[model samples]
Target: MEVLRTPDQRFAGLADFPFAPHYLEIANAGGPPLRIHYLDEGDKDSAPVLLLHGEPSWSYLYRHMVPPLAAYGHRVLAPDLIGFGRSDKPAARADYTFERHVDWMSAWLTALDLKDITLFCQDWGGLIGLRLVARFPERFARVVAANTGLPIGGGKAPLPFKLWVAFSQLVPRFPVGWLISKGTARGLTAAEKAAYDAPFPDERYKAGVRQFPLLVPITDAHASVAECKAAWQVLAQFEKPFVTAFSDGDPITRGGERILTERIPGTKGQPHTTIKNAGHFLQEDQPARLVAVINGDDAA
Candidate 1:
């Protein structure tokens, strides 16, 4: 598994991103350790808020939310999933698998020995982050799911997602910045778009990005179908404080939050919100609302 690490310089001068980078190397099958990069801020003693981003994006996605959460006396930690952001990128698409993704992050999570976590997961973040919760339910205290789901490969994926899967594979140049901008309601400034593009210098670095959409397990034949099903079993029994903060403008995950609210016992009395006027990347569209939800702010 030949892994490529993005140059630290690419991340320099990113718009609205000021946190210093921290790294941990986790074991990789048939290869040397893989380095995962993350942002650690706020009071170290406080129960941590774990922010997970999804396909084609990185911890940079949480730039607007981190500082406030940290200031509110919460430890905020956002790791770039392997093959995104400052993390080591596996060069081959075959090297990226849904289970391997979960394994990689699970190792990172346990390595930090982090506990009493409040998770804010979006996109593939939810796919992977929720699995972490299922695998180590004791580590989490609550969850905020946004624009994401834990698909068991039992239902037909919406048309928008099917189109996205096709686009992720067929596009000549994977447009990381453009894709992120397109998923947000207010879109991104040129610099912000460039920041999203910072991780991948060229096509070779995008194997994980290109492969993520295809690994959604939308069909029963998908490899991770059984694993997701097993994860769902754990989620169905999850009684922690779980809340949904879905946005109204996302076509791909529209109404997806219902599955969570209905299935998870934790949703019984928690406040679930629809971030109006925001798109898939509500972190960019409504970061404040997300922060408020994470903080349990009544006004949110």
Candidate 2:
């Protein structure tokens, strides 16, 4: 593997993102070194909360909620999935895959020795993180799913997602960062916008971004379909604590929360909420509400 790491200078002076950077090198032979970047906040002894961001976004998405969660006495750890944020970016679109993503994150979690973690997963975060919990249930304590689902590739995907996949491939420019901003409800500020743009110095670093939309298993014949079905089997029996906090305005995945609430045994009694006014990027649009849900403040 030709392990590649993003230059530290790229992330300098990210406003309000004060957490120190950390890294883990996972096995990815015949490809890039697979550098995973993360942030560890609050006391190490406190209960651990793992914040996982989704596609086209990074740990930067959780800047607003980190401090408050830390203040409430939980150790918050947020990681920028490989190819996003300060993590290494592979040069080829084929280099990014569902199994590879799951393996890379699983290695990082193992290397960090994180156990009894409470997970906060959104978008691809939920897709990959939920698989981690299902595959390695012993390491997790609870899960909070927002704007995410576990798709097994046997059902029709929402229309918006299908259109998104088509547009991402057909578009000539593929403005990765700009497209993310537009997906959010209120958009981002100048500084925040700059932060999202910082990771990719050029289009070459966006191979993973461009490939992610295509990698989602949208049909029953997809490669990862069987594995996802197996993961769903594990999740079907999951009897721990699971809660859904989906936003109301996300056209792409508005009803995804129901899958977890209905299928996972863990979600039986937990309060599920539909956050209003937020779009696909709920962490950016409703960070305070997200935090409240995680802290059990909004339970009825």
State which candidate has the highest TM-score.
1
TM-scores of the models, in the order given? 0.99, 0.95
Q: Candidate 1: which stretches are off by over 4 Å? A: none
Per-residue lDDT tens digits for candidate 2, residues 96-162, read 8899889889989999999989999999999999989988998999899988887877677678888
User: What CA root-mean-square deviation does each model show from the true structure?
Assistant: 0.7, 1.6
Question: Against the unseen true structure, what C-alpha lDDT does each candidate score?
Answer: 0.94, 0.85
Model 1, residue 119: distance off in Å is 0.3
The TM-score of predicted model 2 comes to 0.95
> Candidate 1 residues 65-125, lDDT tens each?
9999999999999999999999999999999999999999999999999999999999999
